[model samples]
Target: MTTSVSIFPIRHHGPGSARSLEHALSQLNPDVVLVEGPSDADPVLPFLTQRGMKPPVALLGYVNDDPARAAFWPFAAFSPEFVAFRWAARASARFMDLPASATLAGERRNDDHDDLHSDPLRVLAEAAGHADFERWWETLVEARGDDFEVFDAINEAMRAVRADAPPPTGREAQREAHMRQTIRAALKDGAVRVAVVCGAWHAPMLDVDAFKAKDDAALLKGLPKVKVTLTWVPWTHGRLSVGSGYGAGVRSPGYYDHLFTTRSAVTERWFARVARLLRAERLEASSASVIEATRLANTLAALRGRALPGLDELNEAALSVFGWDSDLPLRLIERELVVGEALGEVPADVPTVPLAQDLAKLQKFLRLKVQPEQIDLTLDVRTDNDLARSVLFHRLNLLGVPWAKERYAGGRGTFKEAWALAWKPEFSVQLVEASRSGQTVHDAATATATDAARTAGTLAELTTLLESVRYADLSGATPVALAALDARAAGSADVSDLLEALPPLARLARYGDVRGRGSESNTLAGGTFRTLLTRAGVGLPLAGVGLADDAAATLRGKVNGADAAVRLLDDPDALRGWQAALTRLADRDDAHPLLNGDAVRRLRDASVLDGPEVERRLGLALSSSVPLEVTAWLDGFLDDSGAFLIHDAGLLALLDDWMTGLDATVFQETLPLLRRVFSRFGKPERRAIGETLRGGGAAGRGVRRELDEDRAMLAVPVVLRLLGVTT
Candidate 1:
């Protein structure tokens, strides 16, 4: 006779919960223990139950579907599940994962929307308590450190917290089928009493009757499966970190890492690691210093009277002993320890694009986070740049890869993109979370993109797209033009494009000025010079003769806008452009009134024009003048006393010794001008300037003199004269 057995739903990974579970199981001592896992995973049980099978190693169940998906429930040393497994195995218990076969296609489908439908209950409960659920969960479950009963109570509370979660649309059906399958396995094996343990959320859904409607093969048979394989991976403490996402793990991963890795309190070990890391980074800290810091850390914990130093205590200790403030040691430790260079890898099988593609993709399966490294991903979207960008973005959208978007103020076709990538442990953790989306990256990408594009105008869609910017550094997403031309972004459409374009143009302009080669250096990078200048509002031009499509009209517009008093010497050909623009502004075409005075001032400063040309302009200005403010602005440009010192290096050479009467603005502007002036010197003079800059300049005269005398000049300066302090 088949007897009804109780299925106790439990959290996938909880130290305390596992403890309570072990207690319950010991009390029940059933003939068989049914687990909510892949039924096909029986072969791995012995390996998991091996004498040396360490706590924290997980029995990963995956579907080698066309697109593969996996479930990771890592076993911690104090994990209740680990303890219960020990109990069951020692008692010669038969364990079975009665879930539907985790097919690759199904895994892919699940990966497609893994966290997109995150429970609203997490949000609601979080809001109600004015506390973060992840932190709360960590404290009660993971962070209790060897306290399993506390973990069980906390998880039980969380079940109640998430009790009112929205009903699963079809996931329930899929889960129940797996349940019935497990029950069928038990019945076939003729087990009298069976104890099943799974997530509390799945508890209510278990039982044979619940899955009575499930068609074992019909419901799951068509799902594309893949021949995926598995291997052991060293789990890091930081991988369990949680914040602002679906599968939140823990807050202080560094502390938890110590908890799991060491046999005893390893706060001192953490300190040693931190000190060594700091020294490796060229920071000086003695062994005594590290020991003292450890002592302080333990003291801090004792002051508050905890079992040992938690992450907060450690940070406080670091901030006090090794830092002036709370930033130094932590920053050093994070770079050295948190994202360590030890991400475990497992070799993937052959490249197969079956229905279970998500199960394993292209002979590569990153079991955990990659060790921190600089990643260079060059995407080639040459075929149809637009189509390629769409696909890339869609795929990245599914994988949750961060690449940036760009637009051209006005241009078309492919534009280059660049990104710098650094892999963190959290990224590997995210991989597990994102894997629930689809079986294959293609399906996940395509579906995610289609849905996003469908909701193109919605706030949610746009926010999600914008959110990817943070990860842009991770994936080198560099399609410049495609991003700018996004038809869906309305009103402020091409602004992003203009923004992307502005950098290159501005850099080009700056490069020219630095080398004195840009056309903007002549008169300044005019608005017209940059094709993207009009796209974004702020104008920061570097150099080059600012030009537009229509040379004549552009020239005319620039000259007439501010022609009269511009310093043409600043531009080698300032007189010509200024003359043309000045004439236009004076001829009763008052549209670009601002440029009239500036053009004339430039021509005057250059002194290229004879007095007659100046007189003629003066006659017109007096004849039909406009705004007083306009004229005053023009006069102010002409009033600049340092017009002759436009370039700083030349001005500084002459004026550094004569600073008695200098104004603040002129002094402030002197450095750039002097550099420019010195740059413009003739070849022979340039060589002399270079020599002076090297060793003969005033700043290094004493050193040069000593070198001439063949003596080291790095000595205290001798006082040449005695002086008394006078008020």
Candidate 2:
């Protein structure tokens, strides 16, 4: 009636350890197999063996009340724990760690400062004359054949290392105590032979006879607990790397995967894959290059006195054989083959919230692949499928799951939208939290948007939410948001806020046409746009008056935004009203010169003012204003481009004549501001303006240019033929 326990310690994500563990498990065939994972995740263990279950997945455990307090036990196909789970599915298996309830409760002590206990592998690796523990382990255990004898060597080595190491304390102490207790319970349950799989650092401490059960119970007592929920979520290979901040992560999960999956000719297969990837990118990688790379890798490994070529040797060979001058191609190889960007999948029948289920169904229907790597998606809203994709992205963003962030699609018009998408694992918790609003993603997002709109403190927030609602096509939320927006607009007196709110409203109105929403949406958004524009126009003159330099610049930006919004709407009445407001601002001598000059420029650009009127305004501003005020006036008039100066001969001559009349002191003072204004122009336009000035000013240059009547007349017959006139 004696119970025997065999402890198999492993590096968390090591492919070599995984392969060895699998082979060892097949030989031992213990009565019960236990792995290091959240014990609360035991219920979902069955799902691991399901056909649709893929690795690069994690067991997600979170506090039921606050999903933000969560933990992940990630498992890749090459992880020892993943292999153990698969092995344990046929036999009896269980998770043998502290339940996630206590772990997520955040009650662990921090008094333990023992370096050896914290990272025993580092101490052992240092003793072995290696600086990096990962490389040392890979050279010794991973690169070797799958022999159970390596476990004995690992166990013995850990025993020697722990002989001088400090006793585990705080959370580490509690975890080992719990692991020992779990082993005792398994033995007491009539299991003759038990298999305990855990981290190499904790392997030497799991003997049931080495620690007292009473002491273990006392260490476990009074641990705080909370209501916990567990489920499976997809993970990614990039997230499994040490660079991603995963404490138990490997340096190269993809390389480890190649090690575990490729049993024979590992270096050959890897080099072949690298060659194919290079060729796919149109880089020069030939069959001869692949063979040479493989030979160089094996040769280097032999020179280093190693059993097989590791990632370092393989990479070196690839770099040397590929004749790459930069590490850029090597980095590409690393990303594609070393770290990888593979995303895992969970089975459809897995337990999850209704909103998540609905999203999955939608993703499948739309043929959208949920990936870990960021991908650029351009949606043509005119197509039914792309339109649905856009709606889904907007709705998800509303629910605070920014799975796809909106990006500028460039000038493709309203028919196209761009998004940068990269799905995160924490989005699962977001989905669960959002489920309280509704059972489906669309409904939940609509409810969330409606609530936000109702509680929005300002008209700008309301209009912004309204724009998102329109994009999402949230019919249930649109009316509520619009009503909220109108109420805020009526009470709002800040003309700047009114102006700020106009652009989104105008866009919403214009987008209604693209979405084919009929007159109802257009009327709602267009009416709101008109009301805000009218209020903004009435208060703009007062807003511009008596403003300081900074305040004037801020107000000018709002004015520019409003003008652009009006043009975007393309409504004649809106443009006329906006132009009238600009005219009043321009005529008010008390207004900031920046605002006055910008107003005049807007009128000129709108063709409401003729060339003579603009010339008169420029002359008056330059003569009546001080040096600083004149600089501000010029900046506002020129805006950000010198194209106006390049094309308008009279305006350029007027500016040149004014500069020549300035006193030396005034010219010195205004030099910086003039530089600031002209620096905003593009190089080509600035060069053109300089040439016009250098050729004896715009007016003189025009008079100096000589045209030949014969050369001009030579093109008349060709022009007549092009116009289809029989001359």
Candidate 3:
């Protein structure tokens, strides 16, 4: 009943390895071929060879119940397994690795071994006089030969390296044992010959007696099992680099793909492709350049005693022939030709996780096809359709799937949001893991937001999270976040923290109505704002005294936040209370002059002071007695706007009188603030202010409106009552 099984090991992405295996399969014509992958993926093997199916795809194996514990076996056009799969489909081969359930369960059992000190590839690369293993592998193994004999040398090398390395443990040990069992089963099936294609590292261990069949059985016995699914998903050439997190990533998959598919004149064919890529970029890469580069590449290869030119030789030739003294243009060749931007496609019938499948359906329904390239998605969240897209992106972000990132649009565009979206192949893994939270994106986002709110340490972080929840339309999470916000606000005493927390809360209160959700949230926000503003009012003046410029900048942000809160609250009582506090701070001489100026400007903007009253106060503050306050006030109040300078003649005269009286030293000392304030003025405004200062205006117009003390005193009772300061 026993069958003859021929064990052949391969490097995962090596084109030479793929060619050698193809030759071996044709020569031996084995009855069956067995590959190393999740056994569950075997069912979907037919889907891979279906028309329009492409390389640069992966077998996504995960436990259906717990998608977070997953593994990827990616294959490019040049991957040995991909070639083997094609050969096997004709020969009706099967997957011979551990099932996803067992692999994931083994991982959960703490059965993992990772040796930090030793690497077999580094040892071989160093021995080959190459700094990088990929270069060494390509030059020594892939570029020279494409026959079964090459694998024999590779096997012996790996055996020697394995002797010096630590043995596999836990999940790795289980995986190897399961592989052995599958090989045994294949052999017992009575085939004339069986080609067992696996990673070269595992070749020596495949001898049947090394792990007794019963021991293999014992290793897999009683392991916790879960339902698992396998699916084929598209992959990218750029992702072929190790940076994409594939375990056996190729440095240049597109190049290897060329090697795998080309029959003769491989170097010539590669150069032609490079020429095409350069021409596409509007670079000068002609047929003549290709011929010269090919000759140069071959010459370099011959000088180095290589059978064929590798990427390094070809790249060197590209630099010399393309007229590029630097590597900048050469880098373009590397990305477009070497790594490439091509994406693979899979048959639609392949089984996928429910969440992944649902997301695909939703993406289609929403008309947002997943793209391999990055794109900007601008959304007017005020519109229903755009709002849906924005909400989907935010929801995915909530579940730790960052397919899109919110970008600042720079304005008070409360309804406008810009997102940079690039859907990666690996986002499927995140979606699988997130599926545990809930069935739909909306449900999962709500669950994730609630969890974040529950664990959030600060009121600001909680408030920001709540804003994300609202933006994602996870209304279910709002109640949980609001409750957490209340608890956090009660215990927090830092005024800056309260300031940071208020704007998002206030925005939600004001705008939530348009979205049909914020009335209750608004009430909660109003209450939190009242409590925070009351505490901030008592501490604001004290905190601002003697602040450095850096601290003043930080305080300026907090002040702006308070300003936003005032606008959003739209409550007369809260406005009056906050305005009163700002007035008190503005009157204090010891307050940070920046804060004083900001308070005065805020009060002016709020229409709390008449034009003449503001001018009189500026005259008092700009006098020589308060030089430091003048600079601080100028930086804070005059920094952002110059409108008042053009229209308010009283303020202009007060500024003009103060400047005329300043001595040379005082002028020099305040010049920075003077330039800063003037810089904000438009050219026209600056010219007008300049002409007025140079005596262009009518002389002695002394635009002071004399205050009638008796008239002002007549309204004292009304002012005192408004101030809650009755005598």
Candidate 4:
């Protein structure tokens, strides 16, 4: 039996188009319906129909064809395709997607389409009946609230564009080819009638005869395909948003989400909700203020003769009403209302990897088990432990689980991880979303793992990076990915930041112990782990918790952080950097003691000091103290680590050198400056005066000390370098 099938190209979730699609699908009564997808997702349709599953979820599709190179397709709940899928399932229509599937030859095929979507955003004045495509579509199709008219207008508008702006290869080629294929497949099965639903752009291509004349098999020539799996995962408003992308009119998807969900969701409603949410959260906002702002928005809208306030009016209302005119509401309101409570369900029977399924179950369980923001959870995944808790935490993380780091972690290996879970709805949603980008746990964990390998500037960033990358490397992602990070810490002058990046990386590497990787890893891991501690050698003033972003992670700091410089006496990174920073603290003179203390401690800890080496260098320094090598070698240790330094170890010695200072000519110049320093800080600081009154402190003090080294340090060096002495 041969029956003419109708193909509808319409936008998903478009109330107007969807309404029309529903009616058309219901009326046409086609035998089979084809939707657009990677064909591999076809198997998941049954699972997608699960009652627990919700819309506003994405079909996370991945191509492992090339693990090194991958991309994603995210579909949200309000997506038109999802709705169509539901309609097909309900109708019991033999539904299927018509894109390349099972064979992902297309995954490897480079279509070179990046340039295709880059058509100019240029808008002609008043031609499309609205300011831009978005406004035009909203006014003509969406705002009218009439699906029939929406469908008609869409078909007409799309036809006009199709006729005028035909895609280079052929505007109507795809659907025509699809229609022929559908007809042939039906012919081979000896069944009739079919319907195809695709994007509006494909509408003009649906007529069967146009492509029936071509070789259907040949038309699919070189159309590659690959294995893929599609699972429903929640999507954020940002992903659906389209300020700049392929989708249209979703300038602020958060707003559209509100608008589309509730017919109008006017300004007052939006402002009121914001006020209420804030007040509920104890953020100090009032309903009266919101009402006032809503009135203002309404007034503004009336001036424009709009029935209700648009985004501008609502935004202004939010600002005028409850917003602090700065960025509080602007930051939070959208996330609260627009994305709202997005949740996706994966059926137990859905075909998926064990890890993925485990992640899903974990997320579902966590969804119901709400814990407070600040938390600490200790999980023991030992040989005899309950499998549930162990699997649960990993699953949450796999799903981007939100956990507050523990105050203190005890023990080592996967069996001993200290995890604090803060099971938030959004975190789980984000986790699910990440699945679209990366097929497995490792891939989705990119955000944390890659972020771990940071520039490591401050302890704050390093700690944050550590917290973020935790566990991401469990899938062997810790190679080149982590090398630069290790080198970064060693090179980092901020002793605190180096200290921070180490523990987390060490923890991850240690977890590899459970995975059975090796002892070299443990050595490298311990070496890397303790590297910061060693670098923080003794008497290095404790850098107070660099940042307390995580209460738990910073807990250990409160206990032992103040003692890092004092206790970790021989850590190399510490000695190298802080030792230099210590040398400059002399004039403040508060610094010399700190540095000298650290050097002394390092000597004690290492049970070694280059005494002869020191003496040899001391002779070389005196023989030629110049701005360059000869002069530089002559003076005491100094660097731009802190304030300027006078090289003499004690204040009295520094004063002695200043009094003796340079030469008769250099003395005339240096004496006045010494007198000035003595007058400025010399009196108020009793300790400085005491040091100055004291005797010569250390031989390395040389001519310069914390008391009298300045522009002269560089100047003296330059002169000595010129003298050509044996410095």
Candidate 5:
């Protein structure tokens, strides 16, 4: 019997194409079915027909040695190629695709080249006077009933498109040649009936008799080959959208899915779903509105000369019937219904690296669902489960698989941590790559961090790495990081670097007990803190001298941070050393006025300098310094604390007298700085200070004033009651 070959051209991920292909395949009953996919992925093809296998999954092909070099062949339920696979499986026929080894081994192509073959659809849509190719396809094909004649139309259109288009060359030529070769091999294997399902653009070039075998072989000749591993990974609907940068992606996977799944009452059911979602969000969407929306959508479709309502018509109907003023409701519909952000599931037995499997088990145990949408997770380290979750997040971050990004935990306390978690499909390949370090997440993180710490060249880098290690609870990596930190700190003469290094160490020392590491972490972190602080104290005096304004401002911030760290540690010896360094900076005549003023403020805030001494220093600096220097010193002194001026009448009086005495040019030049200082105050505090200035500034100094003795005596009982005293 002569083998009859039938080519079924299809649009990738088209529901109508999938339906028509299924109908055509059942009628033809082909013995061999060829699809356009990676030939090396044949081994895992059986998994597609197995139970628990879901749509929105991808065939992941990666280099054996370096999994970072990877490619994805994604499929949705409505994808024509996916439908062909199921049909072939049910009919007990052979199915295969072109080899992906050459493709994976080749240099990564730009997205332009990746999507070049799909341009025929754009040309056809443009010729049809449609602006969007997806909408054009949806109207002409996806909205139609299952009919095999649609394939014939697509084949004819693609043939016309290819006639004027240049012949395929480079990688595109090789892929089509390999595809034809696969078909020829199937036909030569004594199959009486052969069916090929491929991209519409490539269909015109795949006639085996028209292209000689030698030409196809020569086209594939000299192609680089590499060992590649293939596995199935879960994909997301969001990733299936063109907005996500998938070159061959559809504009509306979720809408296409609804079209494919809903066999009857498509418009009514869609409106019902919209109403249900709106009601779920506590928005008013009544049954009458749903009915009106369905009718309106159908009417719009009729007016637009469409057989059924497309997504655009339905969205308009919903907007009109629901009477929403803002586009927020529409956006919610687009995100939740149009794009449908959902992560697909893979069978537990699917092939993956050990690290990926381990992570899956951990996710299940921790009650963390792998989702495509980002979720904010707040963890309290005081709880065992939360602490474990935090550790896992930190470990994954250390492994360079940032599934969770650490965000600021509001309202202080080291026990609280906040993270933004979102799972991407590419993390599977990242897990495979990270598995080279170790077979498990924790072990891999430790290995990666330890390697980083050993290679880290700067004291600041070592300190930051050590902090991450502590957070991850990587006990194995902590010692290596601490050793590296010590070695780097011992040789570093940069006081700024030393100061930068001290804060994380101080935090580790103070909060180690809270992290469940107990006294061991405390001792190690405490020792490091003392060493860095001593070095910083030694170099700080010289570092403070001969600095520019910007550098002085930056160093002042570092000083503030280091002081806060020392105060957090609350060790008297560390505090004494830090205070001595500040004293030296405060007494230096050659230091920038800003730093000098900040140092004096720090000393006064620490109460090491009494009130009289602070007054003396302030008076001398204002009288002896230039107008610019006086302004800078006042800024450093009053940084972020306008309440201080309100509370200290003598200091405020000194500042007022200096400012009032300045010449007009000097006052105007310093006006901006004065405004900056006052801007930090709260509205009420600013008003109170202004009122104090207007009232001759005696209220803040507790000047004696006349009072009604009888009224005061009457409030004594209320005061005693507030104090809980019994008379």
Candidate 6:
């Protein structure tokens, strides 16, 4: 091979390297520029320079059939490759590297070949007496003029450091051989000057002829093949940060963009942006603050011996001049100014899988743009568009794309859904992978749900998946989910599971029909509800027997759920059967006292039992039971309110007598459970109970005097009128 090729090795996102390369390319005027990237991406080079195309987008390559085997070559506005691509597009260039299908296949089996090359930047940083390579490199290289010799020096240093390193392994050897072959082919094509831009580490190896062409060809021969596709997709600044889980990601993409765009007056421009951001946040950041912050940044640069202020200095200046004692203001600067929130754009005509196109249509229709910034959305489900957005968010979440998270916020109203949405670069990858299930988001989510339903082993899991599917409106998978539900429910003997599963189905049967569940789904859900409720009614009483505190507590929830389900179902026979089961549990002596008391309270709330029956049950529980049993009974009875004690003086007196009879030890033992039960009481009810203990009848009204018959009769019509119930 000829020695006519000059390789400019660069740190991936270094602004200084970009400037140097640009200058070097202008002076050399090479006929062809070869860059390090997947050779399969050669055809897309022209698209990279098309008008309106932006950086921070990536060249994505994956197996067409198996998307899990994939790789990304991301480019930020400051990336040297991005600059090279722009220059090459003006002067026509080609990509020279192994194809992605080969790289991915090699990666599958190359895990055993450990790369021994240490980070070259760290070695140089140590030699420069700096703890961080970025800071040192910025001070020495980036802040200086664009001299192409800096690349030569960097190449020499990296070569010297790796001189004692282990020889390249089999896969790496084959890759280097292929690169050499590519360079040989380019030179033989009569190109007078060739410029190659590659990662700094690979430069030293490329210049050396370590393997012969014939041996390299044999090593690369008979390589495994896989179908692969290439496309361009958007990326984000948050994901461009190293902490966002990309190995080659930068610490501050915004800072690099600033350096790349405005190579001079760096501190002045940065502080002005910070001032604007602070003012937008309603914090005080005037022009005076901007001037002071700029001064402080320059001072910090001087103290740190940096040629110019970097991100660290600028952030420190913002924290100091903003008069914030904490880093809270600095964190805002980091998010808004240091890292940025920009999302890259791909052309509308760009080719993508059908699923991606469908998703884009849905997002556009919903006016939801995938961005790097976290946005809070309050959706009223009564609004059609809002409901559609909610459904899309839920489907994405279930498919393992967490672009949106449901947030529990207060006071937004019952029909309002709160969500926090922030799109990451990996979400595109997830979306692409999810396409294997179906061609649309709904279809994919439904297929995934169906698979989960088929594999579920428990009634609880199936019921949960069913609820999710119903909420997400995945109608196509309804049959699969319904079949799984029926199978699991028919086999499940747990009364609690049956009871817990009935409410959602009952709600669907009652109200879901009006919410567009279709007549078929409503009918299926109604049938499932009836079958499970029937099974639950037969087994509930037995389930109550011999329940420990935890199990009994769990069953009490189930009982409450059963109460709501029967009411929602409103089927005369089902209600009567469920009440009968509750009556049996209440009357059985072997049932847990908690269950018994729950049954009695439910019966009272349903108005099936009169005051006298509640009074009789209270008297029996108070007089005969031990202190713990009595307290447990009180726990279930008192569950969440003291309103029951207000209307019934006889029951209140019964409680008073029971407490007075308990000795000091029993009182102490009962206090905790009593506190737990009383804690559930709201403020108004607790205050009324306290007043009752002080001899004030409900709400400090003294003992109810005999109502004057004439006055009370006259007040009846007034009371009815005030209650909006005309006589």
In the range 1-727, model 5's lDDT, one tens digit per residue, is 8888889987788776777788889888998888888887888888888878888899999998988889999988888888888788865443345466777787788524534366556666777886545556656655454455667778888888679878777877888898888888887888888889988888888889999999999988888889988889999888999899888888888878887778899889888888888899888889999899999998987898777777889889988888568776687788888888768777889898899999998998889878888999988888989988988998999998899998988633467888999999989989999999999999999999999999987777787788888888888998888788878877899999889888778877887735667468668888989988998998898898889989999999999889999999999999999999999988988888899999999999999998889988999889964778887888888777777777777777777778767888888998998898789878988888877766656554542334669868999999999999999
Instruction: Tell me the TM-score of each prediction against the true structure.
Output: 0.43, 0.89, 0.73, 0.58, 0.88, 0.80
Which number leads on lDDT?
A: 2
TM-score, structure 3 vs. true: 0.73
Give a tens-digit lDDT track for model 3, residues 1-727.
4567677877778776677788878888888888888876777889877887887898887776667777777888888788887877677788878787666665544331332122344456667686444446556555556555666777787778678878877667777888898888876777668788988777877777777899889987886777877788888887887656544666777777777788999889988888887788787888988999999999998898777787889888888988566676688877777877677888766766566777777788888867776788777877888878887888889999998888886533367778898878888888888888888887888888999999998778988897788778777999999899888887888877877887777766666634565577767766777777787777777777887878978988887888777777787877888888888888888877788888888888889987878877787678637676787786776756676776666777777767766888988887776887688778887777666555564422544445669878999899899999958
Give a tens-digit lDDT track for model 2, residues 1-727: 7777989978788776787788889988889998987777789899999999998899988787887777788999999898988998888889989999989898434433554554566566787776545557667765555456778788888988788877877788888898988898888888887989998888999988888999999999999899988999999889898899776667788888888888899999998899888889888999999999999999998898776777889889989988568776698889988999888999989998889999999999999888888889888888999988998998999999999998887742468888999988778889988988999988999899999998998888888888888878888998899788878988999999999898888877776636676458767889889989988998999899888999999999989889988998899998899899999999999889999999999999889999999999999998865889889998899998888787788888788878867888989998999999999999998888888877844544652344568879999999999999995
The candidates, ranked best first by TM-score, are 2, 5, 6, 3, 4, 1
List pairs with backbone clashes in candidate 5: none
Highest-scoring model, TM-score: 2
**Stretches of candidate 4 exceeding 4 Å from the true structure:** 1-8, 12-33, 63-71, 92-103, 106-138, 142-146, 166-176, 183-195, 213-216, 227-234, 242-250, 263-268, 339-343, 359-727
638, model 2: CA deviation in Å?
A: 1.9
**lDDT tens readout by residue for model 4, 194-305:** 6667666555555556555456556656654666545554444454555324243244555555555555545656777777777766776776787688788889778865
TM-score of 5: 0.88
Stronger candidate by lDDT (3 vs 5): 5
Q: What is each predicted model's overall lDDT from 0 to 1?
A: 0.45, 0.85, 0.77, 0.48, 0.83, 0.79
Please identify which of the two predictions, 1 or 2, would achieve the higher lDDT against the true structure. Answer: 2
Instruction: Pull out the clashing pairs in model 6.
Output: none
lDDT score at residue 365, model 3, on the 0-100 scale: 81
> 365 in model 2: Cα distance from truth in Å?
1.8
Better of 3 and 6 by lDDT: 6
Worst 10 residues of 2 by lDDT: 107-116
Distance from true location, Cα of 246 in model 6, Å: 1.8
Query: Can you write out model 1's per-residue Cα lDDT over 1-727, one digit (the tens) per residue?
Result: 7575756655444433455577667767877777655555555556556555544454454453421255554555544455666777855344343333444335334422332223322343466562333234444434544333543453465456446656444545555465667667776677777777765555555546644544543454444444554433335444544542326344544444455446554777888888887787777668987888889978876786455665667777787777765476677666446533333332233222232245234213422113345554333333344334434443554466543223332222223333344444333334444455545555554444444444554322332332232112112221221242233333433332333333323232333222222242312222322323332222211110233324323433433222221231233343354345333433433433233444454555656544556555544543442333233323322333432322223322333333323446655654454454345446665555445545555432422221323333333233222343333
**Backbone clash count for every predicted candidate, in the order shown:** 82, 0, 0, 45, 0, 0
- Give candidate 2 regions above 4 Å deviation: 107-123, 126-135, 142-149, 152-168, 374-377, 407-413, 545-552, 623-626, 657-672, 696-727
